[model samples]
Target: MHTAEELLKLQPVVMKQLQMIFEKDRVGHAYIFEGGKGTGTEEMMLFFVQLLLCENPKNNVPCGTCRSCQRIKSGNHPNFHQVYPEGQFIKVDAIEKLLNEMSKTGLEAGRKIYVIHSAERLNVKSANTLLKFLEEPEGIVTAIFVTQNINAILPTIRSRCQHIKFREIQRDVMVKTLVDSGITQSMAATVSMMTSDLEEAFSLAKDDAFALSRKTVLKLVEATFKNVHEAMLVVHEDWLPLFKEREQVEMALDLLLFAFRDIVAVKANPEAMCTYPDLVPTWKDAALHTTFNKLSAQLQAILNARKQLQSNMNKTLMMEQLMLNLQEGKSFV
Candidate 1:
């Protein structure tokens, strides 16, 4: 269980609202915490649950030493239930089991709080089953549904819950958090732009494989102007082999876009911040060798390749074609 102070620090406005709700004893039976991944929604939910179950909460803050708090912290709170998706979807059986558990008396003398993560993954049958429970809440129950995609949830389910939107962490804050976590500034800036989630961006920055992939993209860019054959070789040997999955390929393409953007930045404004500040020397060299028009055209080509990738084209062939286009500086338009 996280401290209320920490939650407030992470999201002051949202937490303050929740604190007000708790302070006024206006806590609702159902709430929907909506936010993207890495927005601290899960952590905030856990903290709120602890606040609800804490025996001695002061100013809506959980006393960390209480037995109830200890049980929550240890993940053995009898009244606290959490439901996660099974495979791709939360099936009916899971909801039924949770409803059964919630229907019974609370093990402790307080509210029975159940958090459903990825609530959007509830299948139709399961959502209907949950709707019944929501329609007739029993035994001081509080239901919290957490989801990244609010639209994916049933409208009926959404209607019964109070929606609390969690905003994405600011880019500068995310970068600073990553830097504080020991990631290099250049990598942190790049990864933070790629994802809003502080933890995910930090993880990506520290991933050796992703780091190598970015370097390989830079290498391919360098090879394209000097030696087309070498660029093709990079695609076959390094790019294709390294990015076997579609998602990895998409990330690699994103890195390539970053590299080109850095090249453009080097030519247009040397003082401008770059996603790859550490590679400014290399970017300068590339910028000197290529014209602004060519770089712009190449950026378009990369975007076109991304579109082709989404069309479910053959991955290997699509990448091969993309490499060839980049080597030739061919504009898709």
Candidate 2:
């Protein structure tokens, strides 16, 4: 369980806003917490809920030992309600039931809070039904809509609530968290740049396959700058074998993109932080030989390959084309 103070590091602005709202005793009836995953939107939501439900809060922070805090922590809070997508969509039936519950008296005395996770998954019917409830909130109620993709949510629903955007967790914080968990600094630096999720970062940090993928990406980069033929050999001999799945191929492309980015960063400033800092000497040499325009083109090629890969393009062909693009600083596709 993360204390409000501990969560402050993850989202200072959001936390301060919530604390002010509580301090002024002006908590809104509805809100939309929007941000990417691992940005602490959910954690802030839980913290805010605890603030509202906790019978005894010190400095507007929930005491974790309190009954309300423990119940909320254990997912057994009576007044706290949560709605999730049943599968692919949050259908009308689930919204109807939740609305029905909201209409009645609360299970406890004070404010009743309902949080809808993956708000983008709400179908038209469910969205409209929820929109009606947002239109005229009854009793002491607060509705929080949480979504990674805010644009997917209905504009009408969005307009009804205060929107709080969560920033991506800082890289240094992520790196420290990973390093404290026993991940090597080099691997932590690379993994931290790849994702903001602590759980996913930890899993990848411990994964041998992920380590090998990083090595493969570096090898491909080296081969590309040396000789096109050699790069193609690396692809056929190594990349294709390791990144057989579409997701893995996409990850490989991301890694390749980062390697080029490191070179560009080195070109701009010799002391710049790098995803692959251990290869700074090689990156500096490549930087000395390349221009910004070439680096930009290489990055675009990698991005274009990623986009094409999502379109169900042939993975092997796409990678081959990408290698040629990176080698020549021009696209052949």
Best by TM-score: 2
Model 1 stretches astray by more than 4 angstroms: 1-12, 58-60, 85-100, 103-106, 121-133, 136-139, 223-249, 265-273, 281-292, 307-333
Which lDDT tens digits does candidate 1 get at residues 199-318?
A: 788788989987898788878877776776888888888888888888988988998898899999999988767888788898888888888888888899899989888888898888
TM-score of each: 0.79, 0.81
RMSD of 1: 3.8
Candidate 2: residue pairs that collide? none
Quote the positional error of residue 148 for candidate 2 in Å: 2.5
Q: Report, for every candidate in turn, its global Cα lDDT versus the true structure.
A: 0.85, 0.88
User: Against the true structure, candidate 1 has what lDDT?
Assistant: 0.85
lDDT per residue (tens digit) for residues 1-333 in model 2: 566766887788899999899989999988899989778788889999999899898897987788998999999887888999998999898898888887776477788899999998988789888886777777678999999978888887887889888988889888887887799988999999889887788899899999999999999999998899999999999999899888898888899999999999999999999999889999999999999999999999999999999999998899878888988898655
On lDDT, the leading prediction is 2
Lowest summed lDDT across 10 adjacent residues in model 2 is found at: 1-10
